[model samples]
Target chain A: MDIVVCIKQVPDTSEVSIDPETNTLVREGVPSIINPYDENAIEVGLQLKEEHGGTVTALSMGPPQAEEALRQALAMGCDEAILISDRAFAGSDTLATSYVLAEAIRKVDSYDLIICGKQAFDGDTAQVGPGIAEQLGIPQATYAVDVKVDENRIAVKRLLAGSFETIEMKLPALITADKHMNVPRHAGLRGVMAARKKEIPTWTLEDIEADPEKCGLSGSPTTVVEIFPPQRSHKTERLEGEAQQVARQLVEKLREAQLL
Target chain B: MNIYIDAEKCTGCQLCVKACPYSAIQMAEGLATITEACTLCGGCVSVCPVDAIIWEAPAVEEVDTSDYQGVWVIGEVGEDGLAGVTWELLGKGRELAEDLNTELSLVVLGDEAGELAQKAAQSGPDRVFYAEDPALACYRTGTYTDVISGLINKHKPEIVLFGATEQGRDLAPRIAVRIKTGLTADCTGLEIDPEERLLVQTRPAFGGNIMARIITRNHRPQMATVRPRVMQRLQSQPEHGAEIVEVPVSFNETSIMTRIIDIAHDEAAGQVNLQDAEIIVSGGRGLKKPENFAIIRELADALGAVVGASRPTVDDGWIAPYHQVGQTGSTVQPRLYIACGISGAVQHLAGMSGADCIVAINSDPAAPIFEVAHYGIVGDVFEVVPALTEIVREELGSG
Candidate 1:
């Protein structure tokens, strides 16, 4: 029942803002938290640990500041936390990312299950979970809403088009959990106190024996050719009137625009 | 890789023919012959008693794949038929096809693709391909990808586009993995670079703080999934049609790992149908609390529009996840969009900026939402919302 949860520190997507003049993210003041989905992944791991009596270890890759996110996982009942961070891991796409994360999981070797959030809020790419699964050569179910574990098999209810499908796969498979699978438990004060005493380990690409060729932007297959602001037309026509009249004006405007 | 039949030892039980998911095997004179439609999925090789069928998984590097030309859209057929995104892709695909000076093909994979494919051919594609069967009637990642990727491998299309729906998001990455190609997800803009003949995929990054323009360097048939409603559909010309190529389907049950045990749709909850809505009235954090969502819904009903929520509102549990409109939720490009109490974050605006007209109602004079809005009203929601609702109720009642 040993489990590994992959977590990430992401900027609060809600607070993230673009600087209109520079056309860049105003990253300085925005708070970073554990990715919302990854928090659910941690919850799934802790719940599994509570039910099956196994340790839940959190794994993440980011700069040193990301250890704060790992500490948050520690506060939520993870037994151990590992952070893989170095300048080499910067600018990695999903392909290179899953490679590094999979290598970290392989180093942990004793795990029987791996869980991840369906997607990162910032990146919004749901590929990394399945990508890690494919890299590890195991069956995977993505967008899982509910899961039940048996000795050798696990049944998952995965969300799909207009419906959810239940799937069964052998143990040692990966699942990318969708939100609302369960309401994550709040970390108790006791857990928070214990987290300060826990030692969080840091791993480097060399420690994981990762191919330098495959660890970063250099090893990545896809590249971001350019980044720019999407063109927007802010030419707003103002219509102000009394409250009751405003709605009528709106309807009339819709008619005038041939949109009614 | 090649798939062929050794008809010499073949017993014409038609087992191999029945097992071929792509209907690539045909019985000729009591012996099975592999057709050009074979996707080399090895669906038939296991079923052959006489060892008559053989398939080799292609070494992606060995295949020239250069012969693959044309921009193809994977037609997503809904329960009834013809999802709007198909026509939208057709509209965009037409331009890409013209730029490449190649043909445009669309593959319709569904439970009943014949009708769907015919419907698609009328959209003015050069060729319309269909692979349909009861196994593929609803989308199983295994079944749909088996049939669709098979067609892609056989045809080597230069570029492929998919609607970033639930099915498309689920299926696209798997196909990209299987076919050994790169996929760009949630692309808002697509264009063919005539110089090198690359598909330029533009999508937001860091919650729309920046938009990344991406291109797959070596992959043949660059794949991308665009959110539905982001592009305009081509005008339907029932009088026009294209060449329809029907690919036969015979799927084996064992190859599929998952089954539809039960279907639980949120439709009973009557969530907002933002994906197809012509108009969307969305609320942001400025609505103040979950109970205030009723105001947004009231306005939506007045205009026969759907209720949409910015990511913050949905994150606050003010509305169901389905009502969310942003990078994390559904991207909607309606005919008209109205925002209330929304500050217009880059991510929030990215989703609905494609609307023909945008109206923003926020008290903050400098709210970013004002930038993209075609109309603006700086006022208090408490006053403005109730007034708008009464007006809508009276106006619609009179109409």
Candidate 2:
């Protein structure tokens, strides 16, 4: 089996804050880390390779700095790493991103399975995995919590709104890892040392035989007309007192508001 | 798609640098230079005081959007019946339909679509397109995408709405890619652009730190997926009769690539119905331990409310993912929401901010959660949560 795990570098949104005066994101000095869920994706791919006796490749599409995320995946045990980055791929949304990723996977030539995190932290669209599957004309199982391979078929336990469903698909299918999939392992000293010397080649549109028109904002159909901070519509009444007193006051307010 | 900064017009005031969320712009040698990090989000285009940054759009064939007509919603069916989000979309779709002066239709696909269609028609759709087949019963991505995309190509509806459920999220993008159209996901606000006559889609991004208003000007059918509780549903009109159009379904089952083996509902059974709950009590990282969730459950049980968890709590394995209340979790609009220990991250706010009444309890006085909360108690969760639960239990028991 040959598994390809897709990952992304994202700003740790927890640490991202807004400037009160300017009402815009204060992105300066924010740390970039691998998207939290993508670690589970890398772990899933590594475990599959361990059990199935196959090679695992880590792939990513982002700016040049995204190579750090691929190196992190390598530190976790991926055999190879590839970064698909180019000026032409800028401003690409999920649809265009999936197209470029599908093209890159096609260039990778042979693969039994493709895995991705359920969604990117920044975008949170959860569209690219299925989009890639659709563009590749293959099957997809999203939000997979567990995956088992049997000869030529794979069974995936997918997480639904509040339930779990088990589904089976053939080889050369796509799977998106849910957070419940597995515990991601940190890079050990030896693993980090090995990954430091690994060569990661960057791929551009021409390298992947991708159409320049279908690469970036030109290929993206959706346009952002306006961007602003979320509106704070509530005027909170703070109850200042001891814990017990505040609790009682809250109950009274709830009763007065008929919410109790 | 080239974006460049004209050096002649540059003032190097660095306004664009502060405006860019991606940090793609930097002042190098007294001029704002674009880097590989630029997503061309156009953040710099409007913020440039000197209008030095230029975005060159690629020329493409203009789409004949004039030919498209009517507003359509793809209805979904759950284990019990039509999902609440289906009704919510219909309720909103009716308004969009009225805005466009077009008919609103609900497309129902299932093995027993005929019965579901009858049940759905009373919900205020002008018409219901019932596409029934065994192959259509379970939502296989390929089968549903093929059928819906085919119908879209044939009908050419002006606008299409989908519930941003797991199934809808899984299916919408594939259909969009197949038909080469645009789709906006998890839109909280949808309206008709008065001047351009386009669907203006507004959604939260960067974990609710920012909101973007999106538009698909050139696409024939404007598509968007809305979260379940984001939109309200119109009441069913018993007197309103709808025309039912039977769609012929012809797809090879053997050609389908994936098969459903089994489905196991939540072991807690029916407890995960946060979407329709009237009240919810959610806990966050303040609990400090997984076992500490008992107080949250106690409070929820006392109030007959459902249990919800913040993303951090769920991510830390303190609770199941289904109990998560945030952008990545379920968006809920309950009558009253009690958030304990949750400092109100923007992502968590995106989910439960719509509650009729929000009461936040955290030790921190300046936690961001209080900004949108209707009531705030600056106290420890361990102390405040148990007290609240005790009072609620006594009050409800006596009442």
Candidate 3:
């Protein structure tokens, strides 16, 4: 019943803003937090640990600064934390990132299940989780809103368009956590101090035996050629009146637009 | 490829120099100049009003792109029949195919897909592929990917498109990984390069703050999953039948990694009609809490519209996820979109901004939602919603 939760630190997407004058991201004062969805992933792992009496480990692949994110995971009831960071992996895309993570998981070598957030807030790409499952030749269920675990298999309630489909898979399968899987627990003082006592392990690409060519920008099949703010040219006709009067005007406008 | 300036068209605007985040653009003698440090992010191209910047990349190692043929869309099952996004993709996909001088094809995979395949072809695909097995009835990541990847290997379609729905999002990436291809997700715009015959995918990046135009260089059978409702559907339903091909797949249900036990629906069924609704009323985190959503519901009822929620409200369990209208939720292009207490996060804006008339009601006049709104009311939702609802009710009663 051992579990590994793959997590990432991302710019708090809500606060991240673009400078109007520069037309570039004003990343200076933005805070980095464990991706909003990954907190649910961490919560799901801890819940499984509490129910099944197994150890939960948090894994992340990012810069050295991401180690803080792992410490936060430890404070949230994980037994151990591992940070996989290397200069070679700086520009890694989903495929390359999954490769390093899969290799690291093989190195950990004791897990029955792996969990990842549905998607990172910044990239908003739900590729790496399935990519890891594909790389490791295991089954994966993405966008799981609820999960129940036992010694042999895991049952998941996956979020679809309008309904929740209950799915079951054997051990060693991967599940991507969706929002509201569980309310992530806030770390208390005792847990925060205990987290400091735990030694965090750092792994380099070479430590995982990752192929150099397939580990970073060189291996990524896609590249970003152009990125610019969405050009929005909208002019609104403001309605200024008491609420009731404004509401009447809205109906009149809709009538004028032939929408009614 | 080298970046250059068209001096004739240059208006001596230095905006590009300031727009370059990398300091790659310098103002040289009152004209913008590109430095060697330029990453070619196309920042200057967007800022240039006179179209003065020329960022050119010559056709590199032209290996007859014509070898790639046929535009393909994966189909999904909906309540009555095929999903709306499936039809939307087919409609948009047909344009891409024609631009490339190729045929538009479709593949429907499910437990029982023979009928679904025919339904897919009714959308005007040149050929329809039914890769059916009982195992596909509910999506198991492994089996679905293998079957579609196998079809891809055999048929070798040049371009493949999918809906950014729950099923398509889950299946498309797995297929892309298995077949060793690149996939762009949540695309809002798609076009084919007439000369190089590459799929040009335009999608929001960095949480909709920026629009990224991505191309997978040297990848065969370019793949993209377009968001629902962003594309225009065909005016007429398919009057003629299309060619159908049944793709053979060998699989045992037990061999797949996952099995679906049951599907449970959330309670917001009747109110969650954001996709097809001609008029929609949506609320956001500004509703304060789940109970306050009653204001949104009341407004929707008075207008005879379906109720939609933003991502935050749904994530907070105030409403069902299906009722959400945003980047991660259903992209609705309703004729009239009334947003209450919505500050309009970029993701939310990307979803519903395409509506014919967007009315935003937020107490904060500075909210970004006002930028795209056709009508902005700076008033409290508590006050505005009730007043609006009563007036609408009275207006309708008078009518």
Candidate 4:
């Protein structure tokens, strides 16, 4: 019943400033935090560990500063934390990202279930969880709203298009959890103190035995040729007059626009 | 170039085969196998129900245009003839055209849309190739793709851009497959690399966790669908007139498969689509109960804004899926986004972070929603939401 929760430290999107000149996100002073979704994954892992009597390991791949995210996971009651930081991993797309993460998981070995947030807030692709499952050739249940672990199988309520589908998969499976899965617990003073002295393992590409070509931008099948902010036009037609009149005029305007 | 198929997960659904339109997928040994004729249009990936199919193109090194050429955008016409997104894409197409140093053109279709050609001209396109047949009035994917593909084969634009609306979503993939070209969807950003003459399509991936840059280096008329409001609309300058070229559409009834039963226009179709709503007030599980959303409804009503909710609230039957905003739900870009009692988890933020201004009201100061809010009010939303609604009502009245 050993569980591994994968987390990422993302730029605090709120504090992210867009450079108007370059139309790119300015990450200079923006603080990074554990991707909010990963917090739930960690909470789920810790709860499962408490109930099942197994160790929970927190894993992340980012720069050196990403150790903070792993440490935060430890403070939240995770038994162990691992950080896989390497400069070469930068600029990897979802395909390459999943490759590296899957390789990292293989290196960990003997994990029963791997949990990740449904998607990261920054990328919005919702591809990594499934992509990782694909790379590992494991059963993946995505957009999982609820989980019920039994003797040898895990029953999950998966979110599909406009409906819920209950699915059952064997152990050593991957599940991407949604926010509705559970509310994450806060780190108390005792856990915080314990986390400070916990041994946080650091792994690199060589340590993980990953193919350098398949683990980063080189392995990535996609490349972003450009990154720029969207341009907005301010041509709002304010409908005036009485409420009913305005509504009528608005409908008429839509008709005129052939939008109705 | 390596196409990976999870056969264990593949249901052999034939959706990819049917969606291919090009018959690129065939049943081989009772499994769906992609042949060399497979155009890599990604039409199959979108239609796969079990999410079993994944096709990855070769790693992008440089733009290779050994096969085809030309830059074309499908000139989408609203009933009245002008679509704001069509204009925005022209601005984008203009940029891509200049980068490739090629002629920028648009394929205009529909009845009496030729008059709209005047508006398309202002976007600085080199030409407006149109089909004014009465049969092309309403958007039929089969017909539109046939007409557009016919024009593409004739002119051969190296790049093609479509507004990722309902019409474009249906039409673009079909045309891409017909032409054996590549198509990217919901692109938030687009750019041309001057050196290689490549159209780099940038979009959020992994539910907004990372941005994936995609390109159709080998495919001719590298196609991408730009989301509406994700790009700036160009001003209509009548002075920048385009060369009006009339392209004849000869798609007979035999080629058309799906017929339009009826064109029931949605009441909210033409107005600010919810995804494009500038001001959104969202409710979530922390709101305590469903009834409390009336406060949210009133606030949204007063502000003339749209209301959204987290998956929990929607799952609890408190709101419809349309009102749910997140990674699994709708993406929004409102001017002002106010989250009431939401904990601000990553999934919820993925949908609303694009807003210009964010205001969060939650009792927990440590709530993740507060971290992203430009303005934070730490208090019970029951009291705070009502008070804020009243204040806005009074302020707007006075103003």
Question: Which candidate would rank higher by TM-score, 1 or 4?
Answer: 1
- Is model 3 an incorrect, acceptable, medium or high docking prediction? acceptable
Q: Which runs of model 2 end up more than 4 angstroms from their true locations? A: A242-245, A255-258, B6-10, B268-276, B288-291, B311-322, B327-333
lDDT of 4 by residue, A81-145 (tens): 99986756654555567778888999885798999986675554455665566566556666666
Fnat of candidate 4 is 0.10
lDDT digits (tens) for residues B1-399 of candidate 4: 244457888877765665442345777776788764343435466557787777654454444565556578787876466677888887777767777777778778888767777667665778888888777876654567667878888777778888876567546655654564566667888887677767778876434534556776655777777877767775556677789988766657543443333333334332324675767888988788888889998888877778888878987888765678876567777767878889976667667777766777777877867656656666677776776666666645521
Per-residue accuracy of model 1 over A186-212 as CA lDDT, tens digit each: 889999999989999899988898987
Q: Locate the minimum summed-lDDT window of 10 residues in model 2 chain B.
A: B266-275
Better of 1 and 3 by TM-score: 3
Chain B alone vs. reference chain B, TM-score for every model: 0.77, 0.91, 0.77, 0.79
Name the top DockQ candidate.
2
Give model 3's TM-score versus the native structure: 0.86
Which residue pairs collide, candidate 2? none
Every candidate's fraction of true contacts kept comes to: 0.44, 0.78, 0.60, 0.10
* TM-score for each predicted model, relative to the true structure: 0.82, 0.95, 0.86, 0.54
Residues A76-123, candidate 3, lDDT per residue (tens digit)? 889999999876675566767888899999999599899999988777
Worst 10 residues of 4 chain B by lDDT: B263-272
Ranking by lDDT: 2, 3, 1, 4
Instruction: Output the lDDT of residue A209, model 3.
Output: 86
In model 1, how large is the Cα lDDT of residue A59?
Answer: 95
Evaluated at residue B89, the lDDT of candidate 1 is: 91
Put down candidate 2 lDDT per residue, B1-399, tens digits, no spaces.
478999999999988887777788899999999987988888678777778989876665689998999999998898777888899999999999999889999999989999999888876999999899998888888888988999999999989999888999999999989988889998989999777889999987887778889888787688999977778787888999899899998877678898899988876625867877889999999999999999999999999999999988887889987788876677788999999999988678867887899999998988988888899988889999998888888888931
Give the fraction of native contacts in model 3: 0.60
